[model samples]
Target: MGGLRNLSGLDASQLVIDGDLKISGNNNLESIADLNGVVITGTCMIANNPLCVGCTCGSIGLAAFTTSTTTTSTTSTTTVTTTTSTSTTSTTTRNPAYEGDVLCQSSAQLADAAALLEDRLRINGMVAFSNYDSFTCDVDATTLASMTAISHVEALEIRGSTALETLAGLEALAAVEFDVAIRGNAALSNLSGLDTLSSIGLDLTIRGNALLTSLSGLSSLTHVGGQLAIQSNPVLETLDFMTSLGSVDFLLISNNPLLTEVDALASLTSVNTLYVFGNDELANVNALRNVTIVGDCFISGLKDCVSPDACSCSDL
Candidate 1:
């Protein structure tokens, strides 16, 4: 069964094919309904079949095919009361929607999930990729580009992507209504892909990115409706790129080992709660001269300072 082009007339529901089963490049094939109870030995290569959805290979047993039988019953009364029942015992069955989290490990699976998200957003105005209310991506840069079509995600997280050097191709995403987190991405060095994002309705967190050197990509971000925290980035040396940000409900800058200057936040004037701690090289809070309406302020661990007055502050 190698190069036949079409299988429209083949109607075998239960089949046993020995050796490797290779079905590829079937352009006209849409459904594999006839191969429902089929069994194949060795490997299964089912690719380049564009129209296939929810295709599964039956389980392998001993050295032959094992098929399960299902039964159905229907009863009707004189008043037209009908009852139907179905019972089956199968080795492999398709899971229903209420099973659990939908795992999307491969790019193809992610594409399918993205399409479903797009559909849900069109009908419902918002979508959470899972029960957790966030769309999580652990894919490479190429696969991440494929996600640019998604625009209505409530929350987003990009982590564990080794090949992501820049956040490019996500130009369509302009808002995150909840939270946005970029963490634990070793090769991610820039946030240029998020230049279009101007606001975050909740916390904005950037942490645990080992190779990130700067926050220049976030230059367009003007407002953070909730807390703004930048912590644990090893080589992020400055916050000069976040100059446009003017206000936040809370602010924190901690544990960024090489961050020495923060004049980028010169425009920021108001914060309800503020904390600046554990930044080894942050000599003073001079960059916060414009901050006049702080509800609460906590400052510690500035290497070049001895007291609150020594931190170029007349009051705390």
Candidate 2:
């Protein structure tokens, strides 16, 4: 059965399926624990159920089964395929190994790279791509859209792509286990693709993108475990999208020539070290009125500013 949008759970304790059993596209299904005694002799396919947080065959405590199944739970957006043999002695869960860094320097390699990432869901290493010298290749929107299935990565870097205008393909990317650096992508104007990214395990650096105008796509980002540096972007004008960011280990906003004010940082409550400098158009930092710094605070190069010993300043 599929497309049962309102069905929350299954409670058939003694259910048995002689043929294939497909349970899919159930948006609100949360538990299948009551199906613990279910017996299935054929393939069992469960996919696209968004709210099934931990509803797995093992989690359901299946009494007896002999079949192969591929389960894709949207809770974490990861796919797991398991095979149960007739011997009942062992159940082998197969997780394909797609390890190491992925580099796509040319357009020719983008399709294969995207396909590999889409199939694997997550990667153990970095994903870096740049069209620095390749006049025939560009990491554009379509190329990034093909990688929609990638939800997590150890690290990600998109740099120096002249034809890349926007980050429109990474809507499903929810987290970065480590750093995420977007730098020197000359034609890149806005971060529109990372709308769902809520956390970065380590640093996040946005630097030297010649045409970047705003931090628009990071509205869901709340935490940066390490540094959060926004530097040297000549045209970057605002941090308005950072309303959800509350804290970070270090916060640095420097050399953004057109940044006039930091009103977007009003939600920032904590930081280890805070540095705001070299922003030519910036006149005041009154927006940092409530930030509490545990380590150090340095403010300079604004039109008007005052150093507060305790890291709170309302008059700039």
- State the number of backbone clashes in model 2: 1
Worst 10 residues of 1 by lDDT: 91-100
Residues 1-316 of candidate 2 have per-residue lDDT tens digits of 4444443365555466655455656777765656655555444555556677665555544423323454333323336865543311222221222467877877788887775555345667898876665533457677677657577889998877777788987888899999999988888888988999999999999999999998889999999999999999999888889888988999999999999877888888888988888998887777777878788778777865445422233342
What C-alpha lDDT values do all the predictions have? 0.63, 0.73
Where in model 1 is the C-alpha error above 4 Å? 1-108, 114-137, 149-152, 306-316
Query: After superposing candidate 2, which stretches have Cα over 4 Å from the reference?
Result: 1-97, 106-108, 131-138, 305-316
TM-score of each: 0.59, 0.65
Residue 216, candidate 1: alpha-carbon lDDT: 65
RMSD, one per candidate, in order: 17.3, 13.1
Residue 69 error for model 1, in Å?
Answer: 40
